[model samples]
Target: MKLQTLALFCAVSLLLFSGCGGISPKPSDETKIDKTLPIVKLTQNGVVEDMNSIAFEWNAITDERVKGIYVYKQRNNLEGSELRHYKTLENRFTTHFLDNDVIPNTSYTYSFKTFSKNAESQMSEMKIVSSLPVLQSVVWIKSIENMPRAAKIIWRPHANQKVKSYIIERKTLEEESWKRIATIDGRLNAEYIDTGLKDDYVYKYRVKVVTFDNITSTPSEIVQVVTKPLPNPVKHIVATTDLPRKIEINWEKSEAKDFARYHLYRSTSSNGSYELIAKLYNPTFTDIVEEDAKEYFYRVSVVEKNGLESIHNKISIQGITLMKPQTPSLLEAKLVNNKIEINWKNKDSRVVKYSVVKKSKTGWFDAKEEEFVDIKGLKFTDPEIGPNTTYYYKVYAIDAYGIKSKPSIEVQVKTPAGVRDNSKKEEITQDKPSRPVNKEVEVIVPTQDFN
Candidate 1:
């Protein structure tokens, strides 16, 4: 009797372990044909409300031997279709099952069975069901082109209230794959502005709806846009080479509707770095330099009101200040008969007049004094000379436009000591002879050029 009790206890323990804590063995094809087990019948047809989920209802099980229900599904439309175990309802009281793994727009065959510790029932009558199609994207989309460094996309809000957000995607014309740029929250948000984009580039965009379940809808119609290009370069640029101590630049006024100003750049060489010199609304500019005959390279660009600047003109223009008159050449400077005489030759035909600059020392400790004398002739004579004093002289040529040439090489001369001026009359006394008295006088002329 004790042995019988031990065997019964072992059998009950095996049943309890197999029914509760153990993984149920999948029914083989031979076992699936067995009809000894009770079958679970569907109470109603399967229902599908969305693309990815389906709802199923079945009659409650009344058999005391039944442990659970097994759900099997098959894609009927696919080749080599076969029934596969999909899910298991461990509780006998579960009359409803939600199948969320079904594909959108696909037909599936479903079967149900009741399973116990030792056997599974024959498969129930197969039900043909399909999930609804994927949610459609927004119907209308528009793109605003020609925006500065940005693109704007606008679309009509999704008609379905289930949509919770929008997914924005973009691609350039040169790209093959699309990129998700932004996710805008709220069904009513209908516009997105994509910034920091390339200028003058073409881009494609599409919109998708995201439901509250996080399932993405199909992409909307593709829309193309082009960012605004830079303004056109300034045309007909010209630079003056004959202006005195200045260079004048001129160009044709921009005809673009967005024209804001002109930017002028200057460089010392054609290929060197250019520095912005001026920004002006007018098309003309003047650059004043410190020296004449100065040359510079120039380029011009047009600026738009949006702060976009056109490319620099590929070919740089050359400009120059007016050339100075030729320097005068000093011919002679000597002290003759108590006076300093200076002479020079004009080498430039543009020279209309000349100037003589005389530099002399006032005293041993005093600063040097300079005197300028203007003359129409080539020679100049200084009559206000001091005896035994040294003098330096330079000659300059002046043009009709008041442009002065560089000073000539300097010359030096020294007057004789105790020299009497011939221009003064001497009074003769009884002690002095009326005859003219002549004394030897030494005149000093520069042997080398001062400068």
Candidate 2:
């Protein structure tokens, strides 16, 4: 309590009792009332404070009757049972309640019942008071200061909790796991700095406070963003065989703004000795898997366009998903007069685009992977292979995440020497193309908006 409060209390007490002189009011056994109930009044029915304390004041009862008054409190104003039935009031006109212990933004109900030997004033209408406690507002500052390798975090103090303690909580975006960052005791001095990160990039942060009865306040707004201006995701990347020779990897971008390009790292093993593979423009990268028929790992690092790596942390390898890219199935390879027509039913929607790689002395090489973009939903016809050469064919599927899958079960296609030399061409020509149904073709197509 402030010093002025004690002085004020003494002065008020002196003034109230001074009017009573040396004689104390006598309590009568009989009730004094013209009606069935004694008259009771209030000087103030409600109060608003800084969640510190309230001086409840009411009109003193008269009629030369009334032995005592009982005060009550209710946390829920709907009110039947008072949280506390009672504290005996020492005065008729006023009682003081310490509100600093109450939660901010909560409503409380208080009332008094005065009694005499034969009658009790009907409980004075409950007074509802609300306080705007010194609750805080959390402000996110410089982000996770130490990033990735050493997740460091920094933020400004809550504006309202100058008289309370503060604590921080964190979790990885990849899992439902959450843990305490730290606790600061003694009416926090304002700012909090967090460190010790396990992932290459740090992603989540929140703040909270504790109050009377150890009741913790609701957490502050969630402020999530990359801790450093570096490529954060440097782990959990996978090599795909779909675009053969080239592997695809992808990860989520930071929730915060102010970032540009991710750094892609390639390692022969999951544990590092990594080399900067590529400076990615997006959360994805496509590169030669490096070694064929061998497994490897990759990760992305969050890098600011300004060239700052967030505290040496990168998105951990654990951040990567292991789901292999799917390979389209039921492939049909046919010869058509020096040209090879490849078709398949897309059982896998991940087939963002299909690549036809041909095996040569140099190893399996893309026949038309670079020429196609977003050709995921299609069939391909290639005449680029030299005639009379039998070529082993493989189909690869890509996904929105850039993770590539293993090359579909390898198949074979051979181009005939000439139009007559292609037996499959002759067989195909014998069958006519299917025509559209009449009713289905008659449907109208609208190219413009209804408006």
Candidate 3:
């Protein structure tokens, strides 16, 4: 029981001395000073300063008992601030120290102490120093705004010889934060081209220089630029609807100085996807469909020399090929006096001529058909037909443009049987009893109409 109680008491004492959870407290400033030990002395002219760094040098110590030295620093801007342990030089003969963690245009107070195994000398007389002012950025910057879908930035290279590279930053007008866009490697490279940018958009840019020691200077002046817009669309487009087997499209020529060509698009319907059919410098185009009564839609756009195209026009023009002539109407068909006759009426005012198509059945499985073209009259008589044979006939009209219409309704007719030859033979009579008299027969057949 006594051993356990002792162990508990030791554990509580350890926690109390180590400030709970086995963590040590922060070290306090040194109060005990050994006046007999030698203190560090600073050189008369051993301080060098720059915008981002400070270097200090001191007289070397020859004391064998001195093991190392401790350096402490305090910011001058903070009120009632104590010196904080910054670094330690483990060798007694070390005479130089560099502080690069300090910022520009800031003052700091520093002190040093010489220490042995168990004792430290008094703090040396404090030294106050300041870093130089911040470095300036490049002077001249220019931006080219008229490039298509891109922007070019140019500037005079930084005059400082310590510069290593340049950092380019950009921001749009709607954004409040600047974004790092590029890092140029060479100090003498004075041009940067930013591509794949939005057209007709405004952007802001600035340049920052990095030194050889990796110190970034202040940003240069901001420059604003706008990318070039797209080319203008073609205007006053017209399409012909009355031409046969072809469509003619015409538009006003582009007036832009950078115009390169025109794009022609075609589609079957107004809402269908338009396909690019042609690219040319001429303002007129001919589309030959080689079919009658066909319709199509079209759109045109202009392209610039940089291959930037204008927006597609929402309105499309409709074009159509010429239609064929109206069909002819059959009026009458009849077989009269060993002949077949067909009559038709022209329904279209554009019809200039007519044609008759005749079909005759010559045998049980064989038939013959013929078309009589360029007939000036509406009625046709076919005398070349065989007797007692059925004949079919149809009529069609033709226009001045050589376009034929649909055939008329079919008409059929059968010719009557031809007259049979019959003559009686007279018995031979002697002397002057009788002379052979010839008998003449005439048969009249009425007209047979098959409508």
Candidate 4:
């Protein structure tokens, strides 16, 4: 009994020594059950930056024991149990991650979990991420002018992907197949210049982008352009005076490409100032002259569909209006047997006919009294003259060109003092002749007011 009491005392003394030594005690059951992990808030959503690539961001975890974040990805069509392990990050202080391996044009679901040395917490709120497909095509392709026989193609850079090169294709109006003309590196500006093209021909173009993985994108929208052609001057230009008081101009139609119209220019002299007279869809023009026997110069130029005019300084021609015949001369008037006889002499053989005009004393010259007289031996007999009154007469000649001649010198005559009795004077005819008087009365026809 004494030994058992000694053992009890020793046990009590050991407990007091252990209490004086300040030894740590075992954790309680409540402390052992608490296994809470870090809670993180998503600062930014997942965003696609390239083909099969996305970036993610989150707030820094507040738990000191958090080792890192664990990322999990799953197809959007699958349930939460189908999530696959994507990546694991060991950096406890890091709050972002970039996932590079994924399928393009597909949707994926993602979540993050905080892990410790001995335990893994429940994942943060689920997030959805999607990786988009590569760019389909470039944008805004167009053709700019480089030369008459060349074409310049330009386009905007592709978006949402990395491009390695560009391919340019062309096709003519009559062709249905496309031909690759150039390969431009993506590092340079999105442009290409194609040379040695046929003039006046229509062409179509399209562009395609190639990725770094050697995948080609869909072709761009089609663009159309027509090359300009050199101007072709008109041939065989002619000018003639076939009409009265006008000049007719003509030229051979140009057979060159893009023939639009013709331009006719006129000038009074060959080296003088030129004026545009007419623009004709046809090849002919008529210039109406204002004065008689005037000279005019003419030239023709070809206008192309592109508004280019051919050079015409080396070609020119001249034309003149029809010439008018001279007037008759030596007009004579005499009173015979109460009738007046008029006669004139024409020096030009071109004169085909003659006209006579008369006026009584103290009477205005009436246009109605003008008469076209047949030039029978160049003489005319006037049976309507009055007695004891004087009359003035003038004459003109008509030429073969339908042109009128100048007025002839005037002539004056008076009948006998007695009235002309119609009963006594039978109508004078060409079969009979009238006796002439010796007295000659004369007046001059003023040409200043002649039409």
TM-score against native, each model: 0.83, 0.37, 0.80, 0.44
Q: Write the per-residue lDDT of candidate 3 for residues 42-130, one digit (tens) a residue.
A: 89987888988899899999999887888889989878978887887878999999999988889989988888766788888899999
Instruction: Please state every model's RMSD to the true fold in angstroms.
Output: 7.1, 24.9, 10.1, 18.6
Clashes of each: 0, 32, 0, 1
Instruction: Output the lDDT of residue 134, model 1.
Output: 88
Q: Give the whole-model CA lDDT for all candidates, comma-separated.
A: 0.80, 0.55, 0.80, 0.72
User: Model 2 segments beyond 4 Å from truth?
Assistant: 1-40, 44-55, 60-65, 72-86, 90-94, 97-104, 131-134, 145-148, 186-193, 210-215, 225-451
RMSD of 1: 7.1
lDDT of 3: 0.80
- TM-score-wise, the better of 3 and 4 is 3
Q: What lDDT tens digits, residue by residue, belong to model 1 across residues 124-149? A: 98888878888999999999999989
Model 4 per-residue lDDT tens digits across residues 194-213: 87777767888999888886
lDDT of 2 by residue, 128-174 (tens): 77766445535554454444344444556555534367676787788
**Any idea what lDDT model 2 has?**
0.55
